[model samples]
Target: MEDRKKDHIDLAFSSRLNGDMVDNRFDYEPMLGIHGKKDLSFEFADKIMQLPIWVSSMTGGTKRAGTINKNLAQACGEFGLGMGLGSCRILLDSPEYFDDFNVRPIMGDDVPLFANIGICQLEQMLQNRSEGELDELVDKLQADGLAIHINPMQEAFQPEGDVLKTPPIELLKKYLEKTDLKIIVKEVGQGFGKESLRQLLALPLEAIEFGALGGTNFSLVELNRSEAVAAEVYNPFIHIGHTADNMTHTINQLVDKMGYKIKVNNVIISGGISSLLDGYYLTEISKMPAIFGMGSAFLRHSMGSYDKLQSYVEKLANGLQLANNFLRVKL
Candidate 1:
């Protein structure tokens, strides 16, 4: 036992942390709050969640997608986090893969679970003037809202992509006018810019997810899938879009400018967030009620085992508890 303890100490001594660990806003003051007493729970989209980490939309419409979705739902149920399912457009025309998207039983009746669809799919529904199937999709899945993912670059790069006749903002505005379901506007991988963020903030949305640049650039995913010539032509666009930090600042500025009149009151900081610290910082910096999310990270964990996913979430919950007591965002 003594030898094992010495080996563990040696291993810890071999690893070194950098000076970048410093958060500019805080002092090394005496810790006062009891860790267990700190409230990590919050209300989002009419659902109360114990943590603010969202399992951002990633997979559906695949053979193994059921396992992944069910694993994620089970984790959210255990940890009290939120989930947004990947594109449910497949369910609109057919129920062939309905089980792939059905996860409410695993997730239980609570937690913010929303179905997702591309803007182009919604555009088609607008043209047909029938959102009956869409409403049914929500009702069947028992989702809290619909997340309309705006991904023009991804579509343009995809081989069988649909062209948009109108801009996403216009489509969203029109859809809101005629429908009553809750809406959440999100980017695919390229996060929103100042102007686009401004417009989305004006709407009464459940939340705005910063599908910022950095992690899983969907344009790059589609570009790689495209023919070599097409991939070369569209490669530059994969570098576009803002970061989560930039979007957080933009949301704060917009809220400041609009004061109390801004309709959107929540933001989901996702995309490039790779660690719990990034999640903590972005969530704290945003002026609105904010949650941090990850796709590839959660996807990697969920695709393996429920135990693996739960272990990851357990670390996150512990880190968040420590962060709430020790860290503060820079002004």
Candidate 2:
């Protein structure tokens, strides 16, 4: 105790924070709440998640992907969280990389696991009348549903990117009419505009994951891979997307205006969600039932070892519980 007090005294001068460093979004009511036993459990994707955290899709079909996915699945299983696999495009015609994404056994049957595919790939399947492969892909992985990531900007920036022959909404409508498979639609870095969100809310989607701006921008990713001139010319386009807060406000207004017209009831407030506070704030403001997702954050820890990933997930759960117990969003 003496040593601890000495250390505290030594660090006290350096630990002083400025008034501008305060977080004003939440009202910290320490007196009204105790850090007693708290339950952060919530139902999402038809599964009860102990922590409202989703491991957003990051990578697959790479050398390190197997180890990373194994670590991630084990973390989710241990923490009782949900996960979305990186693009399962490689699994469409080949089973060679199937083991990398086959994480259901590791995560168990209790948590939600969703397979991901790009909207461009879906369009191609529809064009060739090979959409049946999608269902087969989902069944092979034992996934509860599928997440269709829409990345028009990323595709446009890629030199060898697939052409989006049809609008994503039209493709989604066509696919929904034929399949009973549960579906989620998300963006890649750049989030949806107001009109896009309106059309999506009208669909029978299981959920909408806002892969909003401020995270890993795939458009910027593709741009970096391009020649210098192309990258320079297209740099401005990378900043044209919406943030999590912007999307949340837009959805809330739409809900108020549309009433029963809003078909999708759940949302995964992803992108730019750097901390538990960001997740808590966005989810609190959203009118729909919401959880938060992280891609790069989980991928970074999962690349090392299962023990590292497990520790990180435990910290995430504890931090979120603390936020829920003490912080309230200021209206």
Candidate 3:
């Protein structure tokens, strides 16, 4: 069982694809009325933000992951966006062994910070702890909310992936009952469809991050580790999911027509958002508090010296400001 799980995780992480290239078909437009300085101070429940973006969860299970999380948190603190720590399962599983990992330094007092754990992990958490323990962890971390990531595609491609015995929506409801912290249901990469959204909405969720298909292809990730039959079977499906644009349209239409009012605390469109223009377009079209959480880009940038990291942040800021300016015109 353990070997199978290891194989699954290895396959999921092995995908040698960059998020920026896969979702590059989008065109940039200068939309008027998008800029009008409409106070961008949004919130994840009570957490306030100068901008509507957050650095989405990237990594933190291993030492290398911890370094990435540290840099990411620092970037989030510098830029006024929220930061999400990657899966804390390893840390939670063996706190002493991973005691070196820390999230406080990368986070800011005012900016939002999110704790991440998979849906399967949540189900296990529900069995072990009382409600208070969950609440305490939120309070301890000073996190504004908890992100329950849904990544069945990665799992399905994983050689030893956990057999998802039950629907995650049910587990999500269980978590909702136990914590006061807002619950955010997010996809890792594969975008959510209407049926999936419907199931998610049935649970008490604060927001949704449509980690759409156009960005990071989990199938490609699996393909890197897969051999023989599995690789061939999965490789063809790399482009099978919805793009960020499609997801935005679908979710907006659902709210507009279906009257399926899920708090929609925010709509994070984070598949192929690489440039300032990309971020702007997503915010304009989705019309929700959006985020351009560039996991792979950030990872690559961080591989260099601190100066390079700083430069990357500068570029991101410039892009955001440019987008803001472009959107302010009254079309």
Candidate 4:
């Protein structure tokens, strides 16, 4: 554990000071494009919804995580938003953990729920699992879609992180071709750029979650747990990547330039989305149908007391309403 902590710190420092220009380009316009004028209503695998805002993927391994996910699902159901569960790796690997992670009780048939798994874990599924086995996992949770998260930086920072051996684009294409369900291409903390997005767009994907850097700094998380060398390498770039606002704008612009050639079902603007205004601004500026908020701030107010959670949900709802009204008049 001590050595792991050191490795994190090294990776953090290296990433921060490395002086790499993080790319931020989108093929769509910021306003008045395919996503802006087109009807937001769309079918996500088995679920259909009018709103685009979704409760972004968080955690679901421990009891506390399960509680959080349950509350989040309830909130999502109430708000008419989509919801995604955290990585199912631990649960899939350990039956004991799976028994404890109860997401079904919180999910609703009407709500769009997505099951998440990492690229590294895809190898496990390919080894012995059949389509029916994978489908059973989603069926058990009543998920509407499957999200495959890419987080090489997160892994490199973590001491026990999986070494990403190859590019996942081919694997993702295979999964897309095989699954009869919606496949969401997501990033963990490091946001996606033009090249990566183009590659993903080539696949038959349902959506993209640009998990921009700003909210949760997993690199920093690893740094706190890392040691000498890794810490030094990754510490400087704590705020290394693009902000949520920048990423959203870029993606919107990129999608517009592409002339709506790629049928991206949704664009999830996550990371650093805190207050109602942040949500409002993101929804206004981006062409994507929805925005995702994942940090503890939103969850902190939503968990435990129903009234408190309701109030928090209302605030976000009001913000979206305001944005929609303003867009109606402006556009």
lDDT of 4 by residue, 183-239 (tens): 888877767776777666556677888777877766678777988888888887675
In order of appearance, the predictions have TM-scores of 0.95, 0.98, 0.80, 0.78
What's the lDDT for residue 55 in model 3? 74
Off by over 4 Å in 2: none
Clashes within 3 Å, all models in order: 0, 0, 6, 41
Error of 4 at 16 (Å): 38
Better of 2 and 3 by TM-score: 2
**lDDT of model 3 at residue 166?**
60
Model 1 per-residue lDDT tens digits across residues 113-200: 9999899999999999886677888999999989999999899999989999899999999898876778888898899999998888
Ranking by TM-score: 2, 1, 3, 4
Q: Is candidate 1 or 2 superior in TM-score?
A: 2
Best first by lDDT, ranked: 2, 1, 4, 3
Q: Pick the candidate with the highest lDDT.
A: 2
Question: What's the residue-level lDDT of 58 in candidate 1?
Answer: 71
Q: Which stretches of candidate 1 lie over 4 Å from their true place?
A: 1-5, 18-30, 33-37
Residue 263, candidate 2: C-alpha displacement in angstroms = 0.9
- What C-alpha lDDT do the candidate models reach, one value each? 0.87, 0.91, 0.68, 0.69
